[model samples]
Target: MATDRLGLYVHIPYCVRKCNYCDFCSLPNGGAQVPEAYVDRIIDEILSYSGRVSTPVDTVYFGGGTPSLLSSTQMARIVYTIRKSLNISPHSEWTLEVNPGTLTKEKVDAFFNLGFNRVSLGLQSIHENEMKTLGRIHTFDEFISSYNMLRDAGFGNISVDLMYGIPHQTLASFKKTLDTVISLSPEHISVYGLIVEEGTPFYQWRESLPLPTLDEECDMYELAGRQLAVAGYEHYEISNYARDSYRSRHNSLYWRFGEYIGVGAAAHSFFAGQRYFNTDNVDDYIASSGISVTQTPESECDLEYEYAMLGLRLKEGISLSDYESLFGHSFIDGKEQIISRLEEAGLLTLDGDRLALTEHGFYLSNSILVEIL
Candidate 1:
């Protein structure tokens, strides 16, 4: 939980099939690639950090198109490399993002043996029609099977991801999805609003798709917060909810502006007051050993803006004292009128030194942030 510690993010940019709405840097038909070569490249990238990054890594997150697609042996290779090359803490929270139908009992056991204590399952919906419309390869039954496999293997920390505002998705269907997932009682739940990114199939078909209107999406978001709270899950972030002590530690680092190092194709890093990212082209990453292309340094003013912006995503919001100490100026210096107006509208809460969004504010966080920042 300490901000001084580092987090490692390993990106696996391959998937069985690209979802219609996905625009992330990933290659479909990943099974056709030589797994061993990609795994070796990732290991090499990890070793490249040896002796350079000395901060103890307390969290490791395997995120991607589908990290569970890798063979257990392949995953083990990367895990071992990280342990050997980095100051990896023994109690680190290692999480793997898995898709249903890509896991088995043996694989689950292997992941546990490799020191993974958390598993994030991607289950967008429970309805057959919705899953089909989303281009998800797994059935609701497959997700249940995968969840059970993790539980049976003694993995207590599990997070299930759900989405609202999908094509042809309705409030009733989303509520059913929430009910079914809550019944499972996973340690954490993430409800995301769908974004139709440019260049994605959804963008091309935007007019024809039966996507939820802005009002409908807002309704679904409210429904999630209400139901998840009743189910004993804390809405810790804008989209993330968790039971006691189950908030995602790895992701928390990001919101807190803590330093982290990312490895693999299209991965990003925020460390030593600089932000940089690797090339999105997987083939180029393999050839270049996942070299990072650093960007221009952000101005001190830029840093201050970012720190407050990212911190406000948390329910805890920003500590005014800390912000002033870090930037040597009051966060409210120029934004008093804006903050006062937001508070009067019940969109923001200013409790002494802490400033955070109200539930309503979180729903319109983008516009609110634009005004404040």
Candidate 2:
């Protein structure tokens, strides 16, 4: 199943209002009113890949600006088209990314009915002030309501997104957020450290903002790992936690360097040994029927390096024997000294044939990776 399976990502570039800290491709005013023509373009793109993709799609992710903003009818049409045009497996994990205020009970039921078995809710923090600082449109109560609606609709798999290193966010406040989210007991959790990207409003106001210090941010990250582990969640990836088999299959595919096709504006894809992305402009994507902005075939060296880089993100790390089979050389062929040095530093570990980062090494992964690679 792992050999030839594919993942599908549908990007909905519509949001009620862009967050101050976000630099992702999205239109602030488009969520409230997604044009039918845009939806049709997505459908057409899916159809275009019908006969080309030989593998069965095992995972489908509807990521967004806010995918929950689509009307029930529009969502249904897209789902219908995917099933009709693609070799989607019956047991595929279909995930929809939603914002609190964007969901309703009817929409929740419709999502489940349309085969979206997993939902990733974006609720960065519960504190009203912190929410405002992040430019979120929903209140804490609204998020609770949305979660309740999803559960009431019989949706068992849910993932909540949390953020740290926020402006004026204290350790105590972040601890409370973790406590509150833990109490809800979602199937999966993702904790991300806020990055003030260059084009975002946060970047413009960076000098005046009271962001948590680097030490405090590190503390928050450590606290999350400790608390989540105690709460019976596995730190499966650098920023993701899951209970049992609840890990995000869609995301896991990417970390494995598996093939996937992305549809819609600004979506990226890796298939046929090539990597490409659609234009960010919605109108341009619609007119071109999802023409790629750029398409480049990846070299064997690129894939080997990519495999090593992405595999390192997982807690299980990369399999040296498997790497040899794929690349016709040992991953540690010429880097024995560097690997030994890192192992001595206790930053990395070689257990049997699998090479992985130690618990402490995860914190310094970027630097460790730079040194090794």
The candidate that achieves the highest lDDT relative to the unseen native structure: 2
* Runs with alpha carbons beyond 4 Å of true place in candidate 2: 290-293
lDDT of 1 by residue, 1-373 (tens): 1256999999998888898889988788735543677788889889889888888999999999889988888998999999999998878999999999888889899999999999999998999888898888889999999999999999999999999999888899899999999999999999999999999888988889999999999999999999999999999899999999999999998999898989988889887767888889888888885455657577898888889889999999999999988888899988889999999999999999899998889999999999999
- TM-score per candidate: 0.97, 0.97
Error of 1 at 290 (Å): 6.8
**For model 2, what is the alpha-carbon lDDT of residue 306?**
87
Candidate 2 per-residue lDDT, tens place, 1-373, comes to 1358899999998899989999888889734667788898999899888887779999999998899999999999999999988898879999999999988788899999999999999999999999999999899999999999999999999999999999989999999999999999999999999999999999999999999999999999999999999999999888999998999999999999899999999999888767899988888898985345578666888888889889998999999999998989889878889999999999899999999987778878889988877
Going through the candidates in order, what is the number of backbone clashes in each? 0, 0
The true-versus-predicted C-alpha distance at residue 138 of model 2, in Å, is 1.2
| Deviation in Å, model 1, residue 222 alpha carbon | 0.4
